[model samples]
Target: MKINSMYPPGASGGIRAYASATVDGCLGIRGIKVVEGGRDGLFV
Candidate 1:
């Protein structure tokens, strides 16, 4: 499944919300976990 949003990363807008939703969906799949870090592709 493909998901797209208009919110920016960690910006508390649609993008961030979409990311969180995607994470939840990914987790729903057995043995699948979407591990994401950093901020907007930059290392933390």
Candidate 2:
């Protein structure tokens, strides 16, 4: 299964919470990867 989670580059807690949830459902998985992307707009 492939899971793609997208967040607003700097949405602090969003990424953290998503990661925790993914790990919680892992059952003897061979491998997993967490990829993050930056937002496509101004930082301000």
Q: For each candidate, what TM-score against the reference?
A: 0.18, 0.22
lDDT of 2 by residue, 1-44 (tens): 43444334355532322321244566434323343345643221
Residue 35 in candidate 2 has what lDDT? 38
**lDDT of every predicted structure (CA atoms):** 0.34, 0.36
Worst 10 residues of 1 by lDDT: 12-21
| Candidate with maximal TM-score | 2
Q: Write the per-residue lDDT of candidate 1 for residues 1-44, one digit (tens) a residue.
A: 43433334454322222222244356432222233344644221
* lDDT of model 1, residue 6: 31
- Model 2 local distance difference test score: 0.36
Worst 10 residues of 2 by lDDT: 13-22
Model 2 lDDT, residue 23, Cα: 40
Candidate 1 segments whose C-alpha is farther than 4 A from its true place: 1-29, 41-44
- Candidate 1 lDDT for residue 24: 39
